[model samples]
Target: MAFEQPLDRTAPSISEAIDHERGRQESTLGMIASENHVSESVLEAQGSVLTNKYAEGYPGGRYYGGCQHVDTVEELAIEHAKDLFGMDHANVQPHSGTQANMGVYFSVLEPGDRILSLSLSHGGHLSHGHDVNFSGQLYDVEQYEVDPETGYIDYDAVASHALEVDPDIVVSGSSAYPREFDYERINEIADDVDAYHLADIAHVTGLIAAGVHASPAEHADFVTGSTHKTIRAGRGGFIMCDTEHADDIDSAIFPGAQGGPLMHNVAGKAVGFAEAQTSEFESYAEQVVANATRLAERFTERGLALVSGGTDKHLLLVDLRDSHPGLTGKQAEAALNDVGIIVNKNTVPGETRSPMVTSGIRVGTPALTTRSFEEAEMGIVADLIVDVLDTPDDDAVHDRVTSTVDDLCEEFPIYE
Candidate 1:
């Protein structure tokens, strides 16, 4: 039997928007650090009929019936996650990385528990304890900052701060940080402070899986991550622990944070983890880092000051202060958007501008790497981005860059 949908008959506008979004993806470069293109198989799994079922509880102990097949999906996802991260146990629920962090916090942290995390403008995630996020509102939050001169985490300073605050939990991870973290150092700091160490490896899941970067699973007490970023999985989150806290983690994700699991997404996670297990995925992950390195080199060669001087991962933060002093991140982001090169405005270390109008733009190479882009092509793309920033007011240059991007997209068709 074949499945077919007359989307135009039921929802023409929504279908059109979906198609248009696909077109946009195919035409434009997606430079967001936290985004990637899932495979067609993963997409199929995510859009499957499993969405109709509600799997509220764990496999073989669900509150609802008819979850036998979805149980297999979730179990496969869980098993793959354990193998992928080399963890003793895995929970493939939580809906997102934010919720995964929430699950870890709920499992161990009480309301108003002391928490120490990296500051937002310095590369930490909002869920880490931003004033607007639940983590902040519920916990007693303290933040650490990147070193102004180096644009990187100051481990010594972090240890000093950790000792001063004596937090119940110390969070290590970032949304826009490009360099690899010293997980061992952080673990030591947490141990010294007698705090739970939670590593949110949401941004570098693919690199860690590929062994291109260090794994936080072996060092942190709890590990939470998203499946969608560099992992090339569909949108979802997961938690990893040493099996001693498995029950509590599961309980936190289920009753404490999220309700029913999205079984279709579980299927997608299974499929994606299977993909990540292959040697091809390892090569892809390597290329992602190489491309990012190439992009950063080219950007620096173009006189754009890169945060931390360079990246050891698939993303980079470009500080436009010295290079394009008059141009705000918002302005640069808009100029890049006009030329079909997508990037996000982000706050740099010691930022004076607001978050919305940041002094930095964070660029990444994951989605492009998924589309089979390599270092040489990444060099060209970086030049195109710098060209747009250089002549933001020149329509002719924008037209040229736009056409070049179109050519590049044609050369690297996502579906083909």
Candidate 2:
């Protein structure tokens, strides 16, 4: 069947915007730590006819009719997730990582339950416990910070804080942190305090699945992650837990949080998850970390101060305060954006700048590694970023870097 629609006529503006966005992606670098490009097959699956289906419940036991095919898709996604992450059960219905977190919270905690998580300025996420987010508003929250000198999460400090707060749940994992969480230690702390450990591995879902990073499935009571970020799967969320909590987690997503599942995205997840299980994917994951390490080395040689001094994963957080004094993260982001080298301004440990204008920038290698960039290319890219940061106001520098960025984008085309 010819499934193409007359999008040009029906929605010209939207179509044009999409075209421009595609052009933007094809031309610019996507260095945002949380973002990665999906495969063409995943794209096709996400745009399939399954989008029209409701599929309000889990596989087979749906509330709507005509769900047999979607049932198969969801089951494949769940099975693939379980196999990849080594979890007893997987729930793929949550619309986003945050929604997945909501399902977990709804499943176990009541209103005003205490949540102990890392501080946002110290590399945590809003969903973990920021005042503006629902989790913070709904729960009594206490936050721990990375050690100022070492720029790493101090597990001992976390233990002390957990003991003092007596949290109902202890959240591990981070969004912009360069180092890894000691999942075992955090889990032990939670166990000692009789608190549930929720490890939100949204950013490192791919790395964990590839076995390049540690998996929290064996340590945490609940594991939540986005299917896209490093995993390069569908643009949705998932939850993994023991068989004991599977039913509650599933029900929480169905009736407690979101209404209907996005079955097309589920199809995307199935395809991407299948893609992730390959030896090629394992190589890709390894390259991601290698490229990041190269970036860290290059950035350091160029005099950029990394948050943790280095990364054990695919991202690095550059603190502009020491390296480029008086230059705000917003300024650095604008400088890089002007030259087509994409990155995000972030809050570092000991951050004093407002959230709108942070003190640091986060750079990641997943998208570039997906483009088949190795250490050499990554080193070059790192130099380009540092050059922009070094001379934000120099037009000659901007023009030169822009040419190199265009060349890199052309050489490493995303879809082509």
Candidate 3:
């Protein structure tokens, strides 16, 4: 059975845009490394009547009335999160990954405090300490970068800098960078400096959930993630800390960063977390990585230069400077978008180009794999991606690529 209730009667333009976006997804390839398609169940929970409630405080300690049922939803989300990540405490609010980081900082640091994190251009996220963001604006921020040669995090360099800067919190985790971080090593440096290690696993939440990527729960003093990314939950953020700092985290999240929690999204988180606990989700996560590996191998075989040479998780960064000299990341992005294969322009390490017009493209497999695409399908898609880039302006190549993308999207329908 389907929900036959119509949206046009209530909101024509909004409903039209929603329908158009759905049709867009149904036709194009979603290759953006930071994106994924959520399950219909998750979508339903997010769209539930729970959205009409007010839940201002934690489970029982409510700042508002009529929160009993919403309390249950939030408790389930928190407990499921604790179990999923093996943490002593979980705050399922914060609105987004940046807000989650904000909560952590509020719990620990004062303004003007020193913060050490990866550079945004070198795979770090804005919330970590980009100057335009509050993290950089309020705090004294410094950054560590990938080894310009290997395109990997320079561990020794980070340790040396951490020791010298003695930052209040050393944040680890990134939006790009294809390799893994030695959390234990970073943990040691944080300990030596008597600083807290805030591991923002916003990108690898699903991999960590599936045990494919190492969990930072044991190593970092604070761990934050986006529920939407690899986790495929609602668009929200979370923070996990030990019980010793649980109250601080909860306080920082509520009165500090956000007001009433989005109960519907909290319900959605509970649903997604339950889904993640199953064996099927574990298999799905593993397959996501496998598909990425296949795509990386294909790209390598086709002579494209990959950041860190390849991927160990669900995403990879392709540096196009060597493979396609004149074609900037912006150009490649526009060309791929025209042909129905969606991807984002990214900046590689030692990038000289402007952020808006970078020299690389970041691609991932989580979305396609969620569409039930296997290694074989990934190979074909990878070939098509290379084909578009090889002849971006050729009308015939664009037509062929668009046709193949449509066929694949039809074969692996998302929400129909």
Candidate 4:
């Protein structure tokens, strides 16, 4: 294998781009709600020689040769995931979170099965049932939205809609929602309609694992999550189900939805899951919520309207329609980027703008918290973000914010 060779010598372009990305991450403040920094141990495992192997089947059952070592890695990942999330079975082979959802859908659903999920504009994910995604193209999808006045999902409304639709499956999760979900209530609703409950905890997997946020494992029939975002695991996905559906879920992932598993990334997941069990990780998760709370408080005090008013987890959805009328989320994102702060524009409840140019920005604290940022630092970052949004055209403000961001980045280096 040429795996031991240096990338700079053989693929300079790719190596240069990788270097640039590291530099960018080290220099800027990453506030994107769905992003986080993984540990160096995870980085090493993901970049290991296992990437050169082909692990086409689950542990102790292989369709290919030389899978013995990789099988150990996969088994460790599976066991750790099962222990971490308290699920009876785990399939850590889905290439991404979307594929994880696809695997679960393929296992139990036929074409055109009805799906009831949260609306995309109101903080739901594309994989839940968006028209453009395969989930929607293959399923009959109906959406539920948050209350326009309170900016929170009304459980009564969800139950009413579920009764009317009688869906085959009820999805409980979101991408930009700022409040905790009532998973028990949703599971009960699914029961009333005789529908399966699938909980996609991709964005809050780490928080749930650390016990900072409530877990959906006991309430939902199926659970799916991303390995990278909040978990700092790696760049892959996993599915959790009861033993009754374990074999079905594994086969769905292997032959039904995907091919060979990314064994190296599975190794990363194994390493990250081990790290996440530490007491420090619990405190880190707690600080993440605290920082987000402080940031939301500062935003509200500065007159920025927050969807759901504040956050109960790691992220906030700021609806800019009232505070900065005529200014689009795209503009706010660019202005913040100019000041060395990174965030993504998102659609809020009752969104009127197109997906390309949304009316809100989704900010989070997991990445900053990984860098050891606390409530005081989050307050400062919030002020900087609001200042940029308040005066996007002020050159002096840009320069000042840029300098402060540089100073903060230097003080809290991501990789010592």
Candidate 5:
């Protein structure tokens, strides 16, 4: 299917804007932990005519007519997701991971029920009971923190907190955690308290699918994820659970939170899942981790302090206090962005600064890995970062780095 290219006279001005954005992405280093470049197949599916459908219900039970093709697409998406994660059931309808989490909360917990989760500054997500979100507003929220010294989650402390709070549900997972999670331990704690366990593996779903990360599908009562993160699918979300809770999850997602599903994104997700099932995807997943480890090692060699001392996953949080004492994460982020390397400012464990001006920066290798960058390039990228940080006021250095970045990106050539 060929998309019509707009003639110069009739073209929307947004065409330039889209092209500009794409050019920027192509020329820069994308180190955001939650971002990845999707394959052309996924993009093709996302732009397909399936977006015109209004399939308001599940397969064979739609509220609208003319859903036969959409029904097949959605069913294929669900089946592929189930096979990808080894789950008994799948629901690929939520517009985002937060919505998937909302559905899970609605499925089991009542308003004002106690819920225990990790603190956002300590690597938890906003939907995991942050005060500004509905999860905290509607439910009684108690948060656990990582150890101050080790900068890692302390299960003993988490268990103690859970026992004290006696939460109705225990949520485990994170947005920026660098180490492996102990799902079995979390499950045991939840079992001891007779509480439900919900694991939001949005960031690590691709790794889990590729057997690079531990699988929570077998242990957690409920699992939620975003398809776009490491999965490299189009924008969408999904939920999986034990077959016993399948009906409740379906009801919660459909009638409780969202209406009709985006069949186009679902189709894209199906394609991503099928791709993930291949051996090539496994190699990509392994390289993602390898690149991340190499980056972490480079940071250490350059005298940058890493949170939790190092990373065991695709992302690492750098504590800037040691290398650039007075420079906030906000400043470092801006400086990197100026030189075409993108990353987000984030709070380190026990941070004294505000979220807007955090103490650390979160960096990842997924997008770079997706562009086929290897461990050697990771070291060079780290050196560039160190040099930029060391000479923030030098435009010559920034200009030179930006030129080099453009050349490197040209070699990688994303979306060709």
Candidate 6:
């Protein structure tokens, strides 16, 4: 395949842009739960000649000409994804998780159909049913929330709500809650309500593939996930389902939702899927959990209040109510960013503050774990975080934390 090379003097150099991005990653500690650094092979595939193709449709059925190579790439991506998740069929074309959800909704629901899902404030994605999203605007969205006291999903409550709502679909999975989901139980609830079960494993796809987390493919009727999060691929989305819904799902993603697929990203997804099939990827997934646990423990020991008391996956939600009294999540996020620790402010369950100024921060170990940081290093990171939070005004402490973070990051360099 002949790829178009950028004219050297036509624009800001692509090499310069790449170098700047690499510098940003090298200098900062990325602690966002929904982010990760993809492998070089994935990057190469994402930057390949496949990007120039205009394959408006699926393999062997393009709406445009010259799609032979892209067809091969997309087919590899779909097959590998199906094998990885043990799904009967796969759709590797959604532009994002939101789009993936939108396609699913289009496939199985009408404009005014009642859809039940987890509450956004209680760890659900925006596409699941946030009032501002298309899902909420088009459908009658009823939300199910976690128990405030236990910080876990109340299945009994969820069942009752499903029964009352009589939804057309019941969506499981979360963006923040730290625990394993009982997919079987949730599926049973959906079955009793005569609703389809859709599991969004966007945050835990890597763990699920590594055998560290439960696979929802066998239990849920449909599953959607992002390739960039735990999967460590380029930014994109995928959908999987049983054979019965395969044709409908594929049609929904194509003609029903998006037009031409980004063949470059599809190629990257194929590379990522191949990488995940290896033993090393399994080890990486296990370390992601271990690093998160270590970080959580360190924060607890330092008197920081962690949501749900701790984490069972690669992420932690720290409630700053008690430790940093009067400090908002926005302030904390800014302060931490100043010290080279990148995390996002997030809402806690029943938060008093708005989404922009949350009362909590979400942190994750995936990127650090990708850099090969272990338990001991996580303890150091915990101490640095505590120091910064305790003395946000101290420039010296911030500088020290920055320097220490730089050094630690150097010890476990990425993309070298």
lDDT per residue (tens digit) for residues 1-416 in model 3: 23465778667798999989999988888989889999999999999999889888888899889888998898899999999999999999889999999999999999999899999999999999999999999999999999888888888999899989999999999999788789999999899899999999999898899888889889999999998888888888899999998999999988988898888888888888888998988999999899999999999999899998999898999999999999999999999999889999999998999999999999988898889999999999999999999999999998898998888988999887
Ranking 1 against 5 by lDDT, winner: 1
Model 4 misplaced regions, further than 4 Å: 1-5
Residue 277 shift from truth in candidate 4, angstroms:
0.7
Under the 3 Å rule for N, CA and C atoms, how many clashes does model 4 have?
A: 0
Error of 4 at 170 (Å): 0.2
Per-residue CA lDDT of model 4 for 56-145, tens digit only, reads: 888888889988899989899989998899999999999999999999999998999999999999999999999999999999999999
lDDT (10s digit) by residue, model 5, range 223-286: 9999988878878889999889999999999999988888889999998988889999999999
TM-score of every model versus the real structure: 0.98, 0.98, 0.98, 0.99, 0.97, 0.97
State in Å the error of residue 410, model 1: 0.6
Instruction: Estimate, for each residue in 313-392, the C-alpha lDDT of model 6 and write its tens digit.
Output: 98988889889878899999999999989999999887899999999999999999889898999999999999999998
TM-score, prediction 6? 0.97
lDDT (10s digit) by residue, model 2, range 1-416: 23366888778899999999999988998899998999999999999888999988888788999888899899999999999999999999888999999999999999899999999999999999899999999999999999999999999999999999899999998899899899999999999999999999999999999999998989999999999999999899999999999999998998999899999999999999999999999999999999999999999999999987999999999999988988999999999999998899999888889988999999999999988889999889898898888889999999999999899999999988
Model 6, position 77, has a per-residue lDDT of 90
Q: Which candidate's lDDT is highest?
A: 4
TM-score (C-alpha) between model 1 and the true structure: 0.98
Of the candidates numbered 2 and 3, which has the greater lDDT value?
Answer: 2
In candidate 2, position 130 carries an lDDT of: 90
Assess candidate 2 and give its lDDT. Answer: 0.93
Clashing residue pairs, backbone N/CA/C < 3 A, model 2: none
| Model 2 alpha-carbon drift over 4 Å, by segment | 1-5
Instruction: Show how many residue pairs clash in every candidate, following the order shown.
Output: 0, 0, 0, 0, 0, 0
